[model samples]
Target chain A: EAGVAQSPRYKIIEKRQSVAFWCNPISGHATLYWYQQILGQGPKLLIQFQNNGVVDDSQLPKDRFSAERLKGVDSTLKIQPAKLEDSAVYLCASSSRQSSSGNTIYFGEGSWLTVV
Target chain B: QKEVEQDPGPLSVPEGAIVSLNCTYSNSAFQYFMWYRQYSRKGPELLMYTYSSGNKEDGRFTAQVDKSSKYISLFIRDSQPSDSATYLCAMRVQGGSEKLVFGKGMKLTVNP
Candidate 1:
């Protein structure tokens, strides 16, 4: 079985430019998530999707950030007018609704973003 | 105070030495505790998971949860240079939401 897949493993953009990252979760996983991990810090949840609908996005910067998971399978996270602080790794993860360990999530290699 | 607190250690230890990492959480609702290892420029991968308070061991890794003190620990036995990485502790509420609350993560380096 294949793990989660993400596109554009590394990205570099200007502070005001826009950037997008794509993710394709595991075939049967129903829960999808996007997280931002800055150097020296743990990942912070950006958005979460259950199937095609969003379950949580409380920490997402609504003004400059937008995400979508269409058809309950693939996801895309976008950052417009990116800030220098936006430079970090965008991690995509997925998990079965319930497992022996109560939803063990698997993460992709992540998209590393650098904003100048 | 942060919901989860951890010592962001850049701890260096020799190979074959025992390594211990810990975290304390303020939320009592978290029922599932986990540890994840992340290499530089890579995403985190799960190392251990435990529900409630107890110890769960997998090979060289051991995870312990103490709900009474709202504390958790991860122990690596006979550490190897390959074990060098950032370790993060995460927890979530049982039953409904799957969102994970993460700590700042601690960096460990084992000399060969």
Candidate 2:
């Protein structure tokens, strides 16, 4: 089976510009997640989606960031007026809801964003 | 204090050696613990996961969690050069929203 798929493996934008990343989760996985990983730091959850609805986005910077999973399959995360600090790797992951036990989650290769 | 503490060591070890990694957490409510391996320019992949406090083994990897002490560990036996990567520890608090609290990862290199 194929793993998660993400577009634009790498991106570079100006600090004030807007950027968006796309993710297509595994076929049938009901849980989708977006994470930001800075250099020298672990991946931090930016948002999570259960099907087409959001399950959690407490850490998301609502002021400049927004995300959505439409039709319960594909997801998009956007950052407007991006900041230099927003430069990091954006990772997407998926897991089946059957895993109430919190089993393994598969991740995509990630989109590396660099803001100058 | 950060919820999780980990020593970010760029530790180098000879091949075939035993590799041990650990993380300490501050949240007593965290019940599920996991370890992930990330290669350069790649996303993290789950290596092992443990619930409650005990050890779970798969092939050369072993994961251990101690709920009483809020400590977790991952051990790799007969390590190979392919095992060189960053290891991350993550935990989620029980009875609340399932969000993972992660520690700064430890980078390991297995010399050939």
Candidate 3:
């Protein structure tokens, strides 16, 4: 089985510019997530999708960030008017099941963004 | 205080030695614990998951959770050079949408 896949492993953008990252999760996985990891920090949950519907996005910066999981297989996370603090690694992950227990989450290689 | 606290160590150790990594959290509602290993420029891969405070072992890795103290630990036995990576501890509260709360990862380097 293939692992989660992400596009454009590295991205460089200037402040106030818009950027987007794409993710293709493992087949049969029902839970997909997008996380932002700043340098020297852990990945922070930006959004989560259960199939084609939203699960949780409470921590997302809605004023500048948005994400969607179209057709339940692939996802895209976008940030408009990016801030300098938005320069971080964007990570995508997926899990085969949705229970509060069991299933392991698999992650992609991440898309690193550098906003100048 | 941050929800999670971990020493971001560039922890260096000789090969074949045992390694211990740990993290603490402030939330008492968190019921599920997890440990992830991340390589350079890569997303983290789940290494262990434990619930309720106990010990679980797989191969050369062991994970321990102590809910009473709000602390967790990961131990690597017979560490190898390939074991070098950043380790992150994450937790989630019991129900609802279980988005993980993670700690700043600890970087480990196993020397040859």
Which number leads on DockQ? 1
Chain A TM-score, structure 1: 0.98
For candidate 1, lDDT tens digit of each residue in B1-112? Answer: 9999999998999999999999999999999999999998778999999999999999999999999999999999999999999999999998766889999999999999
If you assessed candidate 1 against the hidden native complex, which CAPRI class would it receive? high
lDDT per residue for candidate 2 within B28-103, as digits (tens), equals 8888899999999999988888888999999999999988888899999999999999999999876445677789
Question: Which runs in model 3 stand beyond 4 Å of their true positions?
Answer: A98-101
Tens-place lDDT per residue, model 2, A1-116, is 89999988999999999999999999899889999999999999999898898889989999999999989999999999899999999999998857755745789999999999
Residues A47-106, model 1: lDDT tens digits: 999999999999999999999998999999999989999999999999996656688999
In terms of docking quality, how is candidate 2 classified? medium
What's each prediction's clash count?
0, 0, 0
After superposition, the stretches of candidate 2 with alpha carbons farther than 4 Å from their true spots are none
Q: Which of candidates 1 and 2 reaches a greater lDDT?
A: 1
Instruction: Provide the fnat value for model 3, as a fraction from 0 to 1.
Output: 0.89
Q: Against the true structure, whose lDDT is highest? A: 1
Scored by TM-score, the top model is 1
Fnat, model 1, is 0.68
Runs off by more than 4 Å, candidate 1: none
| lDDT by candidate, in order shown | 0.94, 0.92, 0.92
